[model samples]
Target: MISQHDFRQNVSIFENSLKIEFKVVIKSFVKLNKLFILWLIFVPGLLFSSSKNDSLLQVYNKHHSDTIGLNALHEYARNLQYEDFDSTYKTNVLLSNLCFSNLFEKKNLTARERYINIYFLGNTYNSQSIYFMEKGDYVKSLELLEKSIQWWSLAYKDYLESYKNEIYLGLSSSYSNKGSAEDYLGDFAMAMDSYTKALRLNDFVKRNCDSSLLNFVLNSEAITSFNIAMIFENMGEVNKSQKQYSKALELFTALTKLKDERVVVTGFLGTSNVLTALGKIYFKKEEYSVSIGYYNRALQIINSLNLKYNNRFNTEYADILTQLGIQYKKTQNYNRALELFDKALTIRRELGNKRLISISLNNISSLYYNMGKYKESLLASAESWKLAEEAKVPQQKIKASEGMADSYEKLGNYKEALIWHKVFKEVTDSLTDQESIKNASTIEARYQSEKNENDLKLLNAEKRLAEQKIIQQKADMASFQIKMWSAIILSLMIILSALITIFAIRQRHKRILKEKLLEEEKNRLRTVIDMQEKERTRIARDLHDGIGQLLSAASINFGMLGKTSQIMESESELFSSSMKILNDACTELRSISHEMMPRSLQDAGLSTALNELVVRSFKNTSIEAEFEILGALERLPQLVENGLFRICQELIGNIIKHSGASEVIIQLYKTSNEWILRVEDNGRGIISADTENGIGIKNIKARVSVLNGSLNYENGPEKGLITSVKIPIYGQN
Candidate 1:
């Protein structure tokens, strides 16, 4: 048998080896199959290229003689970028060299052809930069992005009017990519500057681009807005971040209403991202429930698209899961929180995302510490610290250090705890040092100043353009007036015709309005007639069921007494019972009559009537009912009082029947301007009040409408229903 210590050591070594092997295998697989994986992920657009693109590629390959061939090649390259980035990069390099060589050799290329070539080259560089950025190679991405910007700038100057906007858009995209790279590299000031440049370019495109291109430009602008929001959120500028996020949400929402399928998909994805960002912001603000709602909406979209396996989707999903875990942890749902954190960690590790991996590890560490698993927490913290060091993310490093310190302190390793505590303090202090804080503040201020300056310049330009437009309009107006004077008699005839048309339209509109009002009056009268008929039917049924039966019983009893007719004790008892039954029949008839139009409402006013109605409705029900009257009570018009009483009766009946309520509170109060009737119940609130409408609700709504009052139903505090009706107290009598 193996010694216990030796067996444990062997198991540990084996686990370490297995982890190493697993990582190596995963990395190798990804490296070897990256192109295939990309193609699969983008299969929707890549696997089935447009026939036009295919034909262009075929023509370019078969005959490469002139600018047409170059254009075809550019189109092919554009299609290739989504499918295979390496192929696109190589093809673009050759295309660029060929175009440059032709220019040098005096091959008579048109300016448009040259500009197209340059723009295509810039797009290729930008595409490559995006690839590198996704791979976390910020420096290399920055270099390529700068090159793309340069090429796009040149193209912007050379391109024709129709193509200028496209080139500017390309430049904007490149600058945005550069900003992302700079942000990842911790140069926030530079990142802000780059994003500002992109925003300006996007604005120019939006103002000048044709309607056909407007949607695409707007989508790009929304994306840039979202990115800027993210940067502001990272910089702790909550107000600016929220403003940009709101702007992005508005743009995306509008885009989703568009008819274009491509625009709709883009809008959905963008909207989901904005929602997730809002959720994070709210999460930080400790609005946990609101954050969860946003997160759930985002997750719904991602899952509905079946995009969980996509890298971008995975990243976002993991982020949301991690956030939810934190929320659950705060709520003391340790098991659920742990499960979510582990899921997020697994995704990050599989994607080989070092930065996110470190962050996830730190999160897990913190959760473990919260759970009081000091040993596990320390181990996770150590791994997190190592990963943070490798990723070179200061925030992750600080979080890991703090986790380690806490874990060590909990484990009674005071010396080690002190060391980590000092490290955490140093990192925290450096981040919040006066100089660093000042620099960050200065960067934010500079960004604002630059934005304001750009706005001023844009305003000046717009003013100049407006002045020119006004001058042109005035000249046109003068010319139009001169032409009108030459045909003054015809113009007068036309104006008279127009006046007649306007008069006819006005007369028609008045007739339609009058007809509509008459129709509405008819409907109201019909509703009142129907309600009265129904009430009569109900009263008739009650009399037949109650008074008629009692009278029949009493008559039979008296007849039996007459048949006995001996002045015996049984006969005497039968006569007394008959008298009692006859008395009840009379009382039942009176109650039925009163119910048709409650006598209490007429005699004692609305307050007493409502209280009596509640008492009668909930008399034997499980629901505890109470009624309260506030303010000085006075009489109201008969119609108003009757309507109020009927509405209250209907609501109380609804609560007893459908609300599953344990308690109900009905209040009638008078404010300075209005009378408020509130009915609250502790029960399952209305799930679909519109679709689940019963006769009771319909009756209440009709009565309220007739009274020119408003009725509202919503969920009450602590899982119940609240129904409020407000009527203007017009001269209470």
Candidate 2:
């Protein structure tokens, strides 16, 4: 079994190996795929921050305890930088959240809300600025940084004021970098002032040793001091230059002390770098022993720390070796000097440091020139010139041209030396002009672009904000309309429901009233019908008793009169006719009394009475009528049968009186819940208009309506009018 620590170590090693292998695989794939290669090239280091490891958060949290939430937000902001946005949308989401959290504090809510409406405006300006800076547009970078600083100033005036020292340190770094860019552009005076300002901030922040803040401050100061020292050295201000170098060393030392142990050895190595610079200075003053001591001290420290010497140290080491070589050559130790020069060249070549190689070559060539080995000196000088030209550094080019000029001059080639010197001057002057243009243009364009982008962003933000407001208003209006419509529909539904209830109730009351009126009318009609039936019964009874007795007495008297007048034959015939007339008159009177009351309909049934009437009417009339009967007509009441029989008699009488033709047909049938009666005649056709105007049609309509049935009178198909009526059974009920 592995020990716990060893197991952990193994796991870590495995993880690291996996990471390396994965990266290698990805890189290989990317090399094969152009699209992947493009993505890999531009994808990493995009947001310019790293993950918030414990160390970084600790740094942030220790400094910003007063605003832990803000510190958390800041950590989140920083962490968003490393998110692989190429394949993931999470980064954009996190970035947006970070932006909102940072900008939209309650303090800046109003302004931030306006700012976020355009979303990308302010962010785009900042992004473009950083983009230009990376593209070597130092001037543009500086301008954008300054604009960003101004934006932070306006946007976080209170925050900056509260964090005055930190703000000043940041401003100093910006100015210092701007100055360095200016220095590269050959604006040495501006560079000097900027470096001075940076040093001032560095000094102030150093006294207040807040390590986290001091890190940036001291780092900026060290860079600025180094730059200032270089400028002084260039201008031949050796004393000022040494002072600046010493200041840079002090600041770097102070920073290293505060750094982590991992970087502590590197800090000592930084001190070694200062020793090398000191060596160069001493060499410039012709203090050979002191210069050697500084150089040896630097080399000893580098070896002790086991540090891999970078180009800076390697170049410095080579210079010192060349210097030693030159000093030996002056002491007439030509072989020892040549050996030193060879050692220096080896280091230069190992470094692939062409500029140092040229310098080494120049030293060797000078040493040869001093020994009167003219041909050997020219060869060395030509090699140095070639190396210088290949190096392409401005200083290297000048040194190479000078070396060639010297070589030519020594060879007595005056024209060649003049041409090399002129070429040297021309190259240096053009380099200086081009460098100036690049630096100034970078600064100016950066500043203007930042300002223009900021303005455009502000405008876009305002427009977007206005659009959002309009959309919100429309949404609010729509919501209001929806509510209004719902309320209106609800109210109308309630009103309609109430109206239907009221209408139904009123109709129910009206129906009840109609039923009450019909009941009263039916009762009155029933009473009249009962009284008329009673009167008819009384008349029929009177006719059967008294009128029959009177007619019998009259007939007997007429017979006696006829016996007395029997002398002449004509007289006897008269008496016989009179007696016969008396008998016929009595019989007709009895029939009239029976027809008026219709006792048979009351005692027996309507069907028997109707059959007897039909037989008698046909025998009395010239017209022959055929009647067909169907169904059991057992349900007929006395009043209904009498009314129907009277109606039929009146219709036949009218038809016989008016019609010249003679055939009639009557049909009676009893169906479910109804009795149907139809009368059809064949006679001279009656005009429809005349029939409608007659009282008979009106009577038939009234009777049919009383029974809740229907009556129709029209010209029959052949020649006469047809009248039909259907009365519902038990309609009165």
Candidates' RMSD to native: 30.1, 36.8
Query: What TM-score would every model get versus the actual structure?
Result: 0.48, 0.37
Question: Cα lDDT for residue 606, model 1?
Answer: 91
Write the residue-wise lDDT of candidate 1 on 457-525 in tens digits: 565578669868988999999999988887997889899999999999999999999989966974685
Instruction: Show the colliding residue pairs in model 1.
Output: none
Poorly placed runs, candidate 1 (over 4 Å): 1-60, 63-109, 156-163, 258-262, 307-312, 412-733
| Candidate lDDT values, in order | 0.74, 0.62
Q: Tens digits of per-residue lDDT for model 2 on 448-567?
A: 454686765565578569869988999999999999999999999999999999999999999999998987765665566567668877887788778877998989887776666555
lDDT of 2 at 151: 37
- Candidate 2: give its CA RMSD in angstroms: 36.8
